[model samples]
Target: MIQIVPIDTPTLGDRSYLVGDGTVAFVVDPQRDIDRVLDLAARHGLRITDVFETHIHNDYVTGGLALARATGAAYHVNAADPVSFDRTPIRDHDVVEVGERMRVRAVATPGHTFTHLSYVLETPDRAPVVFTGGSLLFGSTGRPDLLGPSHTDELVRAQYASAHRLTGGLPDDTEICPTHGFGSFCSATQSEAERSTIGREKQVNPVLTQDEESYVEQLLAGLDAFPAYYAHMGPANTAGPAAVDLAEPRTADPAELRARIDAGEWVVDLRSRTAFAAGHLAGSLNFGLDGSFATYLGWLIPWGTPVSLLGDTPEQVAEAQRELVRIGIDRIESSATGEPEAWSGAAPLGTFPRASFTDLAAVRHHRAVTVLDVRRDSEWAGKHVDGAVHVPLHDLLHRLDEVPRGEVWVHCKSGYRASIGASVLAAAGHRVVVIDDQFDQAENAGLPMTA
Candidate 1:
């Protein structure tokens, strides 16, 4: 029996799959975190046979070449536009046999890119499975407009033809496995579900239903701002990511931690937003352990910047270090040792300006206070505190002039971005406070708020 394993892409709702016949396996569209894939293959007693790239991904870095180098597996991409890497290039109609029962047939599926392909796995007694890559997604199709101005009508038409070729020719029972889930930028209408079938997609996916012209128009219409970092990631993936081989994190004693901090080394607090808000080292930046941990770390901290992580547990510290390495930020010194002892005599702990109903009521009595809500516009519209100014954190850098120069209270759902916002405001010499608690705390406290 063949097995398919999904590797989670943290922060982004993306997934990559490993398919094999127990003894030998192949990986498709691997995310930057390759250890999980390697561990999965070892646990199942399978040797990695090949690494395949469906297309150049724009969100997270691809781990295809990295995995191939580590496992000595042959890397494969379409020969039409061969990936400039050290690998074996396969063409259309090429067959890669995995075992007696399973074989991968590479079918050129373009439109998402000039050189995109989907691999179909054929097995006896079961319908073939199509690793659609970005060409076909559940309830949607990959955007044809990612190529920018080069994505003219001709390219869009080519993409439509590619979608038709796959959906029109594939067996109804063939499973459709995609690299990205819902909320990914690769496809406009990415489904929240990680995986779906060809039959299910044919019924609901609008891009598949439309004629060629309409499909192109619909895809181009929804193209929003692509991340600035995407341009660099494709080339990085095509070449290969640098290997991360740091030793196990050694926790620093208080004296050592202070020395590093005083020497101007960055101290990254890896606890949850709430924990960091409760108490953290003075002047340290708090980046929580939720989604986008690595991406944001790479964005905020320069490459090779010496970083010391402070987390609730040793496991969290290790996870943070691994994530940083995924994006090529690899100058980690060590995690803070004796988390409790390190805090001793560090500085007086300061609370994030959490507003209970009573606190909000007290603030409401003051006529000169301003509540700045740093949440996305969509989130603010869905629900929000009354009379709060909605300025999304990403846009805050440019729109700082819009915020009132008064006693300002910054807030988000919790105090993560709000704390960052508060620090930004404080740096600008504004009187600022961060509320890092649930909104209900204010309501339950009978604090007056407008919708």
Candidate 2:
């Protein structure tokens, strides 16, 4: 029996796969935490003999090198990828055999990156399955602009050709497994479908349906700002990241926590938006554990800043640590888990108010207030509250000077980012109210919206 298991890191919006043929398996695009892959392999009674990288990822630190070292599996990387560590230099059309019936063929499909590859898995009885990684995502293709504008024009054209090449070479029934596009910014556009095949994708995917010119134009038009910390991911992966250290960070006492915050080091509170709004360390920022914590935190913080985590439980701190490492933010200065009072010491906890769009609208009638929209540029461009200053959550910290002086009302598509923005403003001494409601509710609340 053949089993293909997807180990999803929903927090990072990526998936790694473990595929086996009863006795042996191969892993594709594993994350920084390799224990999950080890445990999955053990449960399936499979000895992994090979690990493949479709590309040197730009979004997360890869576990492929560590897993290969631990299991003594052949690490297959593109011969063209300039890396520090030694790997099995695989080229286009190089077929690698697994235990018995399984075989994987590497196809050069450069677009997402110049050295990108897609692996086609073949067996005697079953139809073919292709791991496209960041190349061809469901209903979308990987964004080609990560390398910068100089390479974008060339990469985008190559991306169009690569998509066609895969469809031409593989049968329509071939199953598609990709490493990104489940809320990851790597995808050119988001899709609702959970699973798809070449045939299904051909019918609906913009890359396959539209002409290359049309597809490229639409894709370029839709592209928006990605996380700022993405600047560090490529170099970390190229150097081959060290094995992740998820050990509990040194505990921070109240004095130490206050000291770090006073010194301008990031002391993040990993609680819910509601809890954070009620009370938190005055200077501590809230990148709540409930939302896209790592993405937002990594995006906003100055790179190489000493970060201390404050969470409600040890598990929460550990979870945040795991997510941080995936994005290559490996060093955590310290951590604490308990009530805010314990971490506050003599300092009084700071508080902020959270209201819905209806509340915001009612307040607008009586007084002048600043409305801040912290959604992405694309989202703000699509629709947003009129006269609201737009500073995306990723750019909120650096762009705070642009936010007007008043009782500022903050909101995003949902409440999560609004809370983060509100907290930042609150910490900066701005009287802020978090609009903890959906953006869709704004129209119903009689707020003037730009279409």
Candidate 3:
């Protein structure tokens, strides 16, 4: 019987599955960090026999090539994809034997990408399970616009057809696993579900339920800006990504960090917003390794820019490195770990105060303080302090001067970006206050807000 293990890469909100028959396994849709996949197999006493790629992943680098090479397992990709490297090319209806008794059959399902495919797993006695990588997501389907405007309509039609292809013939009880659209940029809408079946998806998935033309219209209209790094990923995957380097990165003392910072390299602080606000390196930007580190960092940090990491522990640095590398962000120059004061050589460490939104409201004049909302444009348009200066966090570094002079009070939907923004203002030698609270509180408390 096939025992499927879902290895969660929380950083990507993506899952890489291990489908095996107690002896050998096939890892499906793994991220660039292969050690986790390998370690999972080792712990289970199973040898990985193959690594599968459902499509040319755009959000993050694939570990299929690297994992296959490391385990002597064949790497499989769609036969039609224009990959430069050697791989065991697969086609629709092809069945690959994995382990002693488990089998995976490829089903042609194009939508998110031109060559995407979903796989059906059949074990000894259990019902079939379909792994839909970028098509037939839980409540939605993969966005068709990632390939640019030229391909949007064509891919949208293809996506509509692909949705029915699964629901049309598959048994209602067939368990379905989707890799994207669950808080992934590749998805058009976020699927707020962790588990779903073919029957359930047929009832709820937009493409499956709506008229084709209407679905197309809604999808086209809903497309938003995906991560900028997405433009770089397709080319890198097509050219064949190099195996990821998982070795612990080299460390830098404070002097080396200072030189790099002065030389225009990034210094990312991977700590909690609370911890970072207490005190941190003067010029470092706070990304807080706990949140959507890769997505935000990839969005804001320029492509191929060199960076240094400062974290409280080696584990934090290692975790941050893994997330960054998945986006082909391999230019991490150096790292520093432990308490901030342990490392010396920079200007005096700086700090700022975090205030509750209620606290800010209770004490003072809205006109007197400069309240800067650092959320995205969409968020700002939805609701914000009436007199606040709007600067999306991603655009803050470049538009620093646009912020009005005087005490700066920063906020986002939540306190996360507020802390990051506060750090930017603090580093620039401005008096900063992080309005560290929920946006809802500001709105519900009758603070003048305009949507």
TM-score of each: 0.83, 0.99, 0.94
State model 2's lDDT. Answer: 0.92
Question: In model 3, which runs have C-alpha deviations exceeding 4 angstroms?
Answer: 344-346, 362-367
Candidate number with greatest TM-score: 2
Tens digits of per-residue lDDT for model 1, 82-177: 356667888778999876777889988887788888899898868889988778888877776666776656666776787778878888888988
**How would the candidate models be sorted by TM-score, starting from the highest?**
2, 3, 1
Between which residue pairs do clashes occur in model 3?
Answer: none
Candidate lDDT scores, in order, read 0.72, 0.92, 0.85
Show the colliding residue pairs in model 1.
11-292, 111-159, 252-337, 386-450
Error of 1 at 248 (Å): 2.9
Worst 10 residues of 2 by lDDT: 187-196
Compare candidates 1 and 2 on lDDT and give the better one.
Answer: 2
Residue 67 CA error for candidate 1 (Å)? Answer: 1.9
Q: RMSD to the native, candidate 3?
A: 1.9
Please give the distance, in angstroms, between residue 118's alpha carbon in candidate 1 and its true position after superposition: 1.5
Better of 2 and 3 by TM-score: 2
